[model samples]
Target: MATIVKTPAGTWKAVIRKTGWPTNAKTFRTKRDAEDWSRRTEDEMVRGVYIQRSGSERMTLEKALQRYLADVTPTKKPSTRKAETTKAKQLILNLGKYSLAALSAEIIADYRDSRLASTSKHGRPISNNTVRLELALLSHLYTVAIKEWGLGLTFNPVLNIRKPRPGPERDRRLAGDEERRLFAALNDYSNPMLRWIAVIALETVMRSSEITGLRCHQVNLQKRVAFLPDTKNGSPREVPLNETATEAFRDALDNPTRPNDCDLIFFGEPGKDGKRRPYAFTKTWGLLKRKLGMSDFRFHDFRHEGISRYAERGLSAQKLAALSGHKSMQQLKRYTHLRGEDLVRDLDALPKRRPTA
Candidate 1:
């Protein structure tokens, strides 16, 4: 019930017609190949398991990734979008020639292994978390292609591969005289904004992005609260500001050289688009840290330090979670590392029980 014909170019074509199904056609270089495809397609149609994979077969990974970047990446957070764009370029370099249908689990597994073995430009081994994020992007692309783009993919190859284990949580807190020295160095710096930013981070457990991304209207000095309409977890949070944090915010807001063109609290130099973005101080921060001989201390550790201090002061986990914008106690626990000395002091402050006669 199938027709096979040799075209002028000498390629064989197979055409199948069924009552319940739409017309299906395929071309092959050999008559046998065409006949085999026709038989397989007809059987699959009868069994109600046939899927037209021509679209997926034709679309290369590079083209698909480009489409994903154009259509999907813009919807994500700025940080997430930047990371995915970088990952997409790496994916394109390695396996972009393969079609969606041809990208099997085995191939993806090999890619994962190779990526794990690779080193970053800084000569450090690539972290498992980085590889995992890359795989996540690929997996989501396939899901989108199938459900939304109608690419005819039967499955996501990334789902079948083993993900690398997550990296260990960093518990690096400020030690001994390091805090004193760090503040001294911050005080001496020409840029007073650096000192203010550091003070705010120490007082309030706000992330570096959250601190830098603050708008003029988001802070209420009278109410001593900073409102975050957008956060990493997709939740709005109101961070309570203590006296120290309020002072820092006031300094940044009342900058004499502050431009009227931008409402950003920490406005950067004008970009190519003539728009002032958030202050780009990563390089400066890193250089300052290294100069102060505290290369191991990261900006995020400030949040950890602040949270730990709060925990030591007898703040309940529920209260800490509310202030820190953590959705769960498990997440809050990572940031709250109470000192043993503080615990001992608290224990001594408790009323002692009288010895029984």
Candidate 2:
């Protein structure tokens, strides 16, 4: 129901009443316009369709960008964090003046093209991966504005936009010959500690960080095991030492000035007077790998080689999971890609079927 009444000044006021909606009232240039609004309001109310009004259309894109950056900076890797922070800060300074609502899909597409058109600081064309990352940050800012800050965003216009294609995957593995080459190179090195650490890393499959943070008191020669306190997965477990790895532990203990601190087993990287610090492979391994003619391989792949070797020998999933400290079989499967051979071997062990009639 709607009512129209002329005021003393000869201006007309219109009022509408509808169920499940607030009373709507307004004045228009014509009675027809007021009546049309009343009818639309009644239809919308019946359909339960209404958008929360937005101030985001007036808010600058830069304001939302700053808030988004602060939300995710702490969670990135140390090397990546600094660069992301710088880029986010710079983008805000450059792009912050535009209104969030007015930054349409076409505008974002153009922005992506412009980034690709520009050359980077390193004299390379800006990568699609980087462009995608920057656009992701932009999208995330809009999401937070709507979901977290109660900014009443009626639409996330970036939803239908396509991200640029990423680069090719890097598949790097150390062949058996390369492993032998690395071993021979280690044997030739003067630094006994680095050599032993390299060998242990290959055999035990310990991560670089794990090796650096290993503790003296954690090794038990009697039980032939070492306890890793806190690991990447946030789970602590025991690692049994092989003969070579145990001998390496003995070599680490053989150092003259055994520190009082039980933390950090594999140490010594020059300076600070041989204090127990993180084991460093950057200098030695880089030179060694280059000398051995396998520069494409990474130090982390030693862990992969060790686990793959075990899988080749037919280690069970449960047993392999324990040794590797992997929480899921899916993760274990990634390290053992060729374990399908084990499946074929199991085929021969099936129970003989009864003779068919």
Candidate 3:
């Protein structure tokens, strides 16, 4: 049943009390409006389709994003925590002024279009991948608020909005001459660990962060494997080391002055206070690339090259995923490319068939 009454202030208030549903009340300037809203809300509740949007209406996107950052961002891997937090902050700056309930597909689409036309500090147009990531953050925020945080959002606005198209897949691989030139440049660089890290990345198909964050106990020289206790996917994986990678570990371990505070294998010299940190070599890599006139290459391309080489060596998709710590075959597909000559060799190796009598 619903009760309609006029308050002392001369406004009509309607309150609904049901057997199973929570009591809901609202005030309107006129009795008719209150009565109509009561009837529609009662009917929706009886049909089990009532969503209490009042909470969402009262909450701003900024508050929701703040809560998500406080509650969810900490659970991510350390390698990605900083970057995800930065992206979340950027999103707050972009859409935080709107209320959760006021956000619509049109508003989100406008945000997307504006971001696509935006530029980075380098004056380069923002990449589609970056815009896509921002949208993904908003989408996930809405999902968490609706399902876990009880924000009472009826729908995710981000889901209805169209996302920008993703950029072309990066197929940049190291050519043989380029690889030789790269190593030659690495030898000229001052950092001794740079060459070893490069070699191990190629030999083990590990990422730059994984390599730089490596510790002594994680590696077992005898077992020829490295145990990554924490990875970007929040799962532990064991990476097998080839002969070249094992030798690299041996050389890194031979550093008598290795940091005792942290077991980091690839660590820099101790500071004035005698504290060692992970080797800061990204700048060195950039300088070397520029010096060699190979500015387009990135440290990540080493992992791509390693995985591509394994695929060309006739490693099956299943085996490659296990080696590369990829949980899905689809994720593994990005690195499964074979050169024309590699495919030609496989074609030549086909067995000849004998004629049947």
Candidate 4:
């Protein structure tokens, strides 16, 4: 049974009280709308399929995202945490006002399209991979809210939605002339560590963060191995050093700028509080890129180049995986794009075989 009353403002207030269920009430501008709502709610209650969506209705996506950032984001790796936080902020800006209950697949698809259509601050179009990552964060938020946070969502809106296709794998590797020009330009930079960063990256196939985050205790020059306590995948790995990498590390250790105050090999100057942190060479790298007119070259490309070079030298997939810290063969394959000419050159050395009877 339902009771519909007209208040002083002439709006219809409908209230439904059912046994074994929480009382649901709503104010509507019209009596018919109030009647309709009460009827639907009562029917849902009778069917035992009614979820108390008060939490979902009251909580906006912005609030959910903020809560997720506070609770779940910290558990990820540092780089992942930072990236997810930024993506959460972007989602809030785009769909903050919508309540969790109202976040349907259709609404999420619209957001996906909008993000795809818009250009980023860097004047580049947002990649499908970036959008996919953003959607993943949103999906995780809903999962956490339902399973742990007591938000009674019947289903995750993001689960059914078609995710954007990821962009093609990048196969950019440094050419001989390009490499020469880059190293020549890097030599002109004031920071000697900048050159060492590039050299070690090409030789060891280590990420920029991995290279920068090295502590003196983590390196074993005699063993020619660098121990990474914190990697992007949250797994500790021992990266083997080639002859070039060993020499670069030796020089880095011998450099006069090697700070005694901090354990970081590429230590920056002390801040206002007199704390030294890992040197951030992004700006320096960018300036060097612009000076060399090689705008497409990114520091991460060094990893790609190093891995490809290793594959060219006849390293097996298993061997490459161990050296590169790649857990998945698929990911390793992406980094192992050998040039057709090199393959042909190897094939040319083999003698032609006759058909067997």
Candidate 5:
């Protein structure tokens, strides 16, 4: 049963007290509304489906995100934590005013459309992958809120909306003479580390971050292996190096400019905290690429080039996956773009069968 009363403020208050349930109450501007809510709530309680949404109704998205950053983001990897913090700022700017209970599928879908249509600060159109990552973060936030934080959200609105399709894969391989010209320019650059990083990536199929973040102890020229304790796929790998890669690692390790206090092979200048971090050369790389008239060439393409070369040399998919740290064959396929001429050459090398008799 429920009790209804009119307060001096002239609002109707409905209070429900059942034998097995905790007391629940709500206030409404109209008595009819109060009676309707009380009936619905009591029915839900009887059905054993009642969830107290008062907290969710009062908590805004901004507050929830703040709590998530403080409580959840720290548990993730450092790179993941940094990326999610950036995405959180965008979510706060766009949807922070809405309460958890107030955000609907329609509202989130509209946000998706607007974000896809928006442009980045660099004047380029926003990429589908960027929006997808942002949406993923939001969806995870909802999942955490409902399951862990007990926010009383019935369902995630993001799950009900369509995610943006993945963008087209890049197949840009080094054209003839482009590689020679690029390396010649790198050798001439004032910084020798850039050339070493580029050479290591081409020879070992290692990612730019993995190569740049290397420590002195991670590489062993004697063993011809580089031990990666952390990688993009969340797996540690020991990348076997060829002669070229081993020599590059040796040169980088024996760098005359190597600092005594820093363990990083490619250490940057001291920061405000007086701590040396991994070298960051994104601006320099971009400027150098533009100057070389290869503005479209990206550092990541070196992984693709290396993987394709390995595939052409008849390496098994299992071996390629081990070297590249790819968990799935399908994902490894994206990095392999074998030249048609090389395939034809292999086809020609097969022994001719005797004519059928």
Candidate 6:
């Protein structure tokens, strides 16, 4: 049973008189409306499908975010750790106060609209890729909670919609003057060690991940090769050294350090003074780019450059894939898209047109 009444504010409300599975709905605005809704709710409850009001027992978006961050973040790659942390903060600001159970496809769609209206500290518009990552993080947590933790989720709204198109691929490969400018900027590095670091960055195109993880044992200078235990591809690959790389290693060996230190190539050995710290690629990456006045250059692009440069030089897709450690040539081929010059060169090399007899 339910009672309907007008409030002091002159709005109709309903009060439930019996316990129901959905916690006994309270306000319906009119007696007839209240009765109809209550009957429907009661019927659903009888079928054991009714979802009651969340009220005090509901989990909040913020709580879900914290759980995801604390439990799920540690297992991710170091590069993604910062991104996941940032996503958690953005979710807190966007959907924090909302109840998890109350979320629906419609609500999340509206949140996407709101996310587009948001900007970063740099005043540039947020990209669809950035927003997509945030949604992905949320979606993953929901899945974990429902499947592994058994939260009884009937639907995951995030999956119901497609993410927006990602932003245009920023040009990553350095060409011509940009490469020269990059080296010019590194020229004034008073610390010879930093110079060696920059040179190695250009020569090997090792990611900051691989760079920081480098150990002396990983470098087989005797064989002019370096083996990565795990690259971005989740597979190991050996990087062959050129004379330029060999020279840089020689400089690295001569680079100033404490008398007794560990085998770390970049950072000095941990807990020791003077160049024993492990090489931190990110710290120097920003300065290197700024010095070159290159806004679009990324450390990751160096890898792209290394792969694509000789990729244009007629390296077989299989060989390139082996070097880059890409699981498939499908994705790598896109990066090595042939240029007009390549096409023209191929056409020029075609057999001369024989005179018609």
Candidate number with greatest lDDT: 5
Clash-forming residue pairs, model 5: none
Name model 5 segments beyond 4 Å from true. 5-11, 352-357
Please, what is the TM-score per model? Answer: 0.92, 0.61, 0.84, 0.95, 0.93, 0.80
Worst 10 residues of 5 by lDDT: 148-157
Whole-model alpha-carbon lDDT for candidate 5:
0.93
Q: Which stretches of candidate 4 lie over 4 Å from their true place?
A: 355-357
Q: Per-model C-alpha lDDT, please?
A: 0.91, 0.73, 0.87, 0.90, 0.93, 0.72
- What's the true lDDT of residue 230 in model 6? 72
Q: What digit string (tens of lDDT, one per residue) describes model 4 on residues 47-86?
A: 9888787799999999998888888988888898899989
Q: Model 5: per-residue lDDT, tens digit, 72-104?
A: 999888889999999999999999999988989
Q: Write the per-residue lDDT of candidate 6 for residues 1-357, one digit (tens) a residue.
A: 556677777666765554543335456456677778767766676687875443323688898778777888888777677889988898888788877777777888888888888888999888898888888988997788676654556667799877877777544667669877777667766555666766676677566567656777788778998899877766788987778977897677655673444676666435544435566556666877876678667776766777776666777888777766677877776556455676798789889998999
Residue 4 of candidate 3: its Cα lDDT? 97
Model 3 Cα lDDT, one tens digit per residue, 211-248: 88888988999999999987777788999999999999
Top candidate when judged by TM-score against the true structure: 4
List the pairs of residues colliding in candidate 6.
22-52, 267-277, 267-278, 267-279, 268-275, 268-276, 268-277, 269-276
Q: Write down the worst ten-residue block by lDDT for model 6.
A: 16-25
Candidate 6, which segments miss by more than 4 Å at Cα?
A: 1-57, 268-277, 281-284, 337-339, 350-357
By lDDT, the better pick of 1 and 3 is 1
Query: Against the correct fold, how does model 3 do in TM-score?
Result: 0.84
* Pairs of colliding residues, candidate 2: 214-265
lDDT of 1 by residue, 202-278 (tens): 89899989988999999999999999999888899999999989989998999987898789998788989898898
Sorted by TM-score (best first), the order is: 4, 5, 1, 3, 6, 2
Write out the backbone clash pairs for model 4: none
Q: Model 2, stretches more than 4 Å misplaced?
A: 1-72, 75-171, 257-262, 268-276, 339-357
